[model samples]
Target chain A: MSEIACVECGAEIRLDEDVIQNEILPCPDCGVELEVMSLDPVQLALAPEVEEDWGE
Target chain B: MTRVAMVITRVRAEEKMLLEVFRQRGTDPELIRDEELVINPSVIDPRWDEFDIVLQRSLSTSRGLYLLELFDAWGVPTVNSLRTASICSDKFKTSLALAKAGVPQPEVRIAFTPQSALEAVTELGYPAVLKPMIGSWGRLLAKVSDADAAEAVLEHRQTLGNYPYHVHFVQSYVEKPRGRDIRAFVVAGETICAIYRSSSHWVTNTARGASVEQCPVTAELQDLCRRASEAVGGGVLAMDVFETEGGFVLNEINHTMEFRNSIEPTGVDIAGRIVDYALALAAQLERGEGE
Candidate 1:
């Protein structure tokens, strides 16, 4: 997972295993919208760092 | 020659206006009921080449997600897309997104259980408003002005049983203009039009017997609305904002909203404007695809 393009804006975005698993990135060029996983584990790496802040 | 399929409930005033716009543009459009969709990722068949864009209409958050996933799998472009829509559809998620984006939204809590709701009420204090997470038309809206009332509402919810859809959205009910709320229609980066919605009841939704009033779009309100839309990943959005003593607090951000009634007074062809902006986004996607 080196670089991926945004589905909406098509800006080249570099991805890390960490960020990819975490499902987060910013279009360094377009500065609009994000490409998040509709479902996960597409490439099947170790799961992204999970955020643990769930409550009402 | 792009066909645009609108995922809507039923063809109503706003939907009719959008269809007219599609016809005016010489674009083929189809109206599909949201409930008809069955979500599956393997069968990604949308006749993608035939349709250039999908416009999501006013649908519940749950059904809206199903349609979003359906389109996503088929690789069709969508207005308000699915990611933003999914976030905005849930009141809790919407507030969290706004707060994360540094946009001003009222504090909110999600109560999955009745006992949790009681505890949340105790902590958040009274005069809080309780609503379902995925709700439209302001249905099941209750303002618990006191502890006893809050307990009663909680008990009622308890009696309703373990309904998964029984998720509650508890918000600090700002003493907004007695049954009045401001709705700002945003297209792209601009606030296309703004209106004031009022009702005799506490919940001021047009669907809840609220009347549309002309709210002067002051620069302050305009800026707030614009910022709110931008914060939530811009496209076409109808932001429901409330005026509070401190300033303005965002009530809700609806990606696929209805505004036919309010737009005429503002002299903006909201339906046309939204279509135009969506076309621009589709064009953007195409250009991106080509690159």
Candidate 2:
């Protein structure tokens, strides 16, 4: 498991060791959107609200 | 009991949906990443035999074509086929095939130099579209309305210096019906569902804030789509069409199509259909019915 503090409430959230970058999750404590910023050290940050549109 | 090789460079929402549908049906495909793969040219990897068919969904155009070509050379069956991917990835190639197939498309001109491009723009008149020969999702496409705009756009592309960017693919910008366009999803030469991308912008792609609405699959559409698919060798394809005063015009064909927004609007289980198609192709190959 990997550990990262939630940006919203500072609540520590445990993630799977193999979590990939750009994987999205919600902070359980504060409900803030969390995004996997990097995988090397398992960084986390408040995720930008995504409109989510990709090209064809 | 058909095995599948799901070639995915990234797990986008569309890929995830396909995976979820496959898992539900108890036939989870092996996810293969090109990044993690090391290839020895002309040598088949033992790992390649585990799957019967390869369904490619790579994001990059260059990577998708190379992988398809490599897999074809190795004699592994692939969805969309090697011929389809190579031709559809290049706008100029697509135009030639569409023309040969007697399909109606907007006027297009290909130029290798900036001077020729400028001349092509003059013949095409103002407000022609200048697009990269190889691209998707409407990136780097410009509408050239005047000589200055044409010169500037062509100059910028030359400055970009990428080989693909220099091959100018210019098309006459047909006025879409009420600023809307249709994208029909075809599976195995059959038209599955059609969706109208409604937007005020000239490019009515779903990625450009276009709202989706279900379009009834008329017989004309069925015939047009099937012809478009067969033009580039039969396989799964997405047909983008436009409506002008002259009627429907085929815009482009996509090999690795995205359909995240189409599901809710069309109410068609696209992922499930794709999984079923992949499995069927695998079965055919196992029975020595495939190339």
Candidate 3:
């Protein structure tokens, strides 16, 4: 597992090796949803909010 | 080996489960991010031809429909065909298809302007539902109990500035038993499993915090699901059904369905079933026996 600081609260967030791009994870401390933007260098960003057209 | 491509906007739980299922079945499926995908209609991308079949799983209905159309034009097989996507993406189109196929569904009326929409809602009677022409997850669904609520909703939608919002699609709200409705999963012309999404709220979509439990697939349900699937050009579909004193009526059909919350309750491997269906479709296409 690789550890990365939460973009919101700077809390340590451990990511599994199998995490895929665009996967959403919740911040353990602040409860904000984070998106794995990239996996190579472990980039993270706030997840996109639900849009009107975003649904199955 | 069948080269399968799963198109998506974000890697949601459903997509992850599907990818794992594909791997477990010994096929490393390609994940095509629809947001980053660029297609040159003038020049064919060789990468597109590499996949034997594509699974249309994009979260955006418009994106999924357009991509399905493009894939169809390229002679690439897709799990849910372009015909299905087009019909299911628009509630009005879906209602027409279902009505023509003699599928039992809620009474619906369509109007262009807010004034006419109020008339349509009035015709459907008070407590009618106002829905966007193209939407899912039960978003923007309003159950107008009276003329006051109807006017407010219609006015709000008119000001939203979106054409779809302006074009009103109204339906008679069916009262459910125990505040629950059935969501049946159909794969490749078969009703694989079903679940009851129960909630105190009128919109009982699981996305809206509805609790779920396995719903037994009765013969009536199976028949209705099969007919509904056929009406919308079948593939992998989720049909929402409403139970009333008369019987069950289809609410809507989702072309790209979400099934993550349904697996445990139904005791059915929905992702696995979908992957198997895609592989079978690939094999059929490979043998030159598919459309």
Candidate 4:
């Protein structure tokens, strides 16, 4: 399993062994939504805010 | 069980709805991510042929189209056929098809250059609309109220310097009741239901916060929707219409449409109807109806 240091509360986050890019996770301590922006060397960033959209 | 494969990029509300319906119906449907899909000519995956049908639900227009094309080439019956997706994806082709089928739609003109586009707008009269030839969610749509606005929009398109941008898609704006437009969902040659999308703004796309309400599915609307579907090669479609003082004018048809809000308003099982349609197509394919 891969580990990530949460950018929010610095909590250690263990990603799924087969975690794919763009998989979203929440910070354990602060609960900030994190998106796996990159896979190699595993970088996480704040998930982009998704606006509530009505049916198109 | 009707074996099905759904091509999707993201699991949005619509996908979730369809997946639930499929599960309830005892379908062991496979969810294929669009990002990981590719056309491998050298070693074609024979596994794709196992499914009776494939459903295209990619949020991106280009990806949906290309994936549908590949599915078609593999002899897999797709929910909305490749022909329907391509024609509806391009606004100009859609207008031609609808016009040829005698479906009343907004007057649209295609100009290769900014100069001709401006001239076409002038001929259409003031307050004309300009839109991108290929897009959805009402993006890149400009309401050119006058010559100045038209020139500015044209100049901006020119500045973009892209080939597709140069081909200006100018349209005549229809006068509808303030903040109201009709969106009717069609599935497999049936006009399921019609919803009035209302908002305070000119564009009444639901994605733009337009509220939706049930509109009576009158015979006239049913007939019009059927004709519109046939005009665009017939499949699952959503028709954007304008109820004007004159009458109902068809605006555009969406192949892979979004209809989360239409469910409550229409009281029709939109996802169920779509799955049923796909199963029917799969049956036909199994019977060798169309290769």
Candidate 5:
């Protein structure tokens, strides 16, 4: 899946990988037809380790 | 009694024609100004359910949509039906339906907020058209040649009225149609007539001072209109077609269409067809048996 901003409403939409490359997707927010582009999926960044877990 | 309900504007030639046709066929049509009758929202709850077949021609006001939906749920038949009419009223919905059905339409996007409107112009680039989602007859359509001008127009529009809460349809501007665009009338998936609308202005809508002339209906144009109508579901439709840089693009589809003096040239008895079609459908439903 790739996240694309709605060209009409600017709402972020997660288009399916296949739909992004081939099909047009309507913005869930505004119902505008958008041409979905293929983009590299962003990997989630890891959170920093807490200094103290002993207290818990 | 063959109960026929006509939802239309106050009174016009088209409405008169429809009434005349119904009368000639011995059917009295009840004229209902669906928008004007809305004294209270709840008033619609009762009268809406009594109609057998609802037909609408001109509904310019935004409030007309409420009536469209009311008739939709009222469990009756309409000329174009509510779903098709509703989609045709909104350009954004029309484009989405067309694209999904694989009908050729210009690349388009809609904008709700001011921010997105700017971005849409940016992405679509210059030389595009910005139109209201639920507009008709070529009102409030602006063709922008550059991004700066497009942004200014959007900014001006935002401040001119209450900000629109949703995105309207925006699309790339098609090349001027050698001074003419095509309007094809389709009924039950069949092409009834096709006419070329010409105007000096870029907006070639008949409502916007365009002149209609008979155009030879090519096989390709017929197929395009048919595909566009079928893609968005069947209806008594008016499909606006134009050739764009990309190719033949379906500009828009009108469900509740108005065919006035323009039909005189086509030699198509539009009023007769509409009335006959309704009567035939009503009969086919097996609901009217000399009642």
Candidate 6:
């Protein structure tokens, strides 16, 4: 496991060992949804907003 | 070895669960990002042939439909075939299929212009719903309680919305007891499990912040789901049903369903079931039985 700063709250957030690319997780501090953009460097970005045509 | 392709836009919780289930089953399906894909219709790409079957899981309905159609044209089998996705992606098309199949659904009317749509909504009476021809997650749904509200919504659609939004699909609003509706997950023509999404808001989609609870799959629900699935050309589907004074009526049929919030409440491994269905389909196609 590794810790990353929450982009929204500037608080440290823990990530699981098995987190995969594009996986979505909520920041424990601010609760903003973040997406795992990459794994090698452990990049996190805010999840994309839902589009008009997005659904299932 | 059965090769499967799980197509997706972004790896949401549902996709993550599906990947985990596939790994647990010793079958590591290839993850195909829809955005990175480039298909040359003039030339056949051998990369696509590597997978026996493609699982259409893109969150974008248009992307999913286009991908499914392309895969079908290439003679590649896909879960929820192109025909199913085509119908499910459009609300009007879904209503027609359900009506033809004798499946119970809410009364709906299609209109081309905003004026006609307002008239249609008026005919359906107050508390009617105006939905986009193609959309999901209960987005852009207007519950018109009066003529003023209907007119306002129609004007907004005509002025600001896109081409699809102008083509109004109006339906009679069915009152749900306690603002709750049922979502039944159907896999391979079988109703595997169901959940009740309750919300104080009129739109009860889980994505809209609704709470979920397990809903028992009764014989009535099972039969309804079976007929609905068959109506849409059969595959993995999610049926939204509303309980009314008359009985249960299907609200919509979803082609690429999300089941992350359903596993715990329903006690069903929805992702596992989906993976199993896809793998079975891949094996069958590989054996030439699907042809």
User: Least accurate stretch of 10 residues (summed lDDT) in model 6 chain A?
Assistant: A4-13
Model 3 misplaced regions, further than 4 Å: none
* Candidate order, lDDT descending: 3, 6, 4, 2, 1, 5
* B91-166: candidate 4 lDDT, tens digit per residue: 8999999999999998889999889999999999988999888877877789989999999999998997467778
Error of 1 at B219 (Å): 2.5
Tens-place lDDT per residue, model 1, B1-291, is: 666787764444567778778889888577666646554567665454356788887345666677777777677888877777877777787888788777777778888877788778777887888876766666567899888998788778667735744677788877666768888887875877788888777788876668887778788887887777767777788888898888778888877787868876688889889888777777777778520
Please tell me the TM-score of chain A for candidate 6. Answer: 0.92
List model 3 lDDT by residue over B76-176, tens digit each. Answer: 89989999989999999999999999999999999999999999988889889999998999888999999999999999998875887889999998999
lDDT tens digits by residue: candidate 2, B1-291: 667777765666778778778778777678887657777886778788566788898766667778888888888889879899889988999999999999999999999998999999999898899998977778788998999999999999999758878999999988877678999999988989999998888877786789889998988889888898889887778899987776678999998898989999899998888878887887878888864
Q: What would the TM-scores of all predictions be?
A: 0.77, 0.87, 0.97, 0.85, 0.75, 0.97
* Best-matching candidate per lDDT: 3
lDDT of 5 by residue, B103-160 (tens): 9987798878767877887798778888766666776788999878877778777777
**Fnat for every candidate:** 0.00, 0.19, 0.81, 0.07, 0.00, 0.86
Error of 3 at A55 (Å): 0.6
Candidate 1 CAPRI level: incorrect
Native A-B contact fraction in model 6: 0.86
Runs with alpha carbons beyond 4 Å of true place in candidate 4: A1-56
Q: How much lDDT does candidate 5 score?
A: 0.69
TM-score: model 5 vs. ground truth: 0.75
Residue pairs in steric clash, candidate 3? none
lDDT of 3 at B158: 89
Residue lDDT tens for model 6, A1-56 = 99888777888988989798888899987889998889999989999998889999
Clashing residue pairs, backbone N/CA/C < 3 A, model 5: A8-B110, B1-B291, B111-B167, B112-B166, B112-B167
Native-referenced DockQ of model 4: 0.13
